[model samples]
Target: MTRHLPARTCRDCGRNRPNHGRGLCRGCWLRQWRATNGRYDVATGTGMGGPGIPKTAADIAARLEDYAFLRALNVRRLDIAARLGVSYRTLNRYDARLRQQQDTA
Candidate 1:
């Protein structure tokens, strides 16, 4: 028989319920993992940007998917690309895509 753990608020999702204190329940956390494709962890905050910061290619993809505002936000694309471990040309592509998306939406 499985033991029932106590409930708690998820620090990440901020939902009240039976959470195991990884700040999220197994299901929500699993969904988050799927969001990250199990390669990166935005929760523990690991990536190229720094400690608890996600900036790698995979991480960038995940962040872009989750936060459209980030795409529209005015930022130095070169700098962003430098930090993201990608080239300026690639950054331009991303920017173009974002602009197209923003324009359409």
Candidate 2:
């Protein structure tokens, strides 16, 4: 008899994306969402004052650096935002973005 692997689905969008993160579909997850505290500017992509668009390794690296550091310390979401001077919700969004960036790279 042959064994069969279970199929997985994307958490967001719900479009049956090969499992990646917790309940996050690649389509919806691939796109940047609001930052940790749930804030955004429809007119521009500047959430926390970096760039209008995602450019330069520094921008991405800066976000990733914060995420990795916080994760390593096992800091609470709220604490992380407070320490990093950002919204908790924004931190959540940033964490996701960092994960995606790492995955792609």
Candidate 3:
């Protein structure tokens, strides 16, 4: 005799589906992951800049200024990255480029 397990429902929205993780369905799991891992707009269900931040020099410069302002106040780089809605690596690259520019100036 084979025993069958009942399908799992999302722990959040309660829609019946296979469990994605943490007892959540796929959509709920995605939402939860995005909310915690990125600057996810709840209403739109997407990230701040869709895919990633723009790579234009002006954009980078503005981000660098923000990073510097936060740093002057003694904010941690990880916290600043979260507050700015960018990844730590991206912020690090921006900082590196800013430093190079300052060195050359």
The candidate that achieves the highest TM-score relative to the unseen native structure: 3
The residue ranges of model 2 lying beyond 4 angstroms of the native Cα positions read: 1-60
Model 1 residue pairs with clashes = 45-52
Candidate 2: global Cα-lDDT?
0.59
TM-score of 2: 0.40
Write model 3 residue lDDT over 1-105, tens digit each, in one string. Answer: 954545697789878887777998778888787767744232122244456534697776787899989988999877887777676667667778878988999
Provide TM-scores for the models: 0.32, 0.40, 0.49
lDDT score, candidate 1:
0.58
Model 1 Cα lDDT, one tens digit per residue, 1-105: 997977888777777767764679767887776665523222222333345433588876764553344445755654455455554455556667677887999
Estimate the TM-score for candidate 1: 0.32
**Model 3 regions more than 4 Å off:** 1-50, 53-55
Quote the lDDT for 31 in model 2: 55
lDDT of each: 0.58, 0.59, 0.72
**What is the Å distance of residue 71 in model 1 from its true position?**
7.0
Across 8-46, the per-residue lDDT of candidate 2 in tens digits comes to: 665555566554455665455545444443443221233
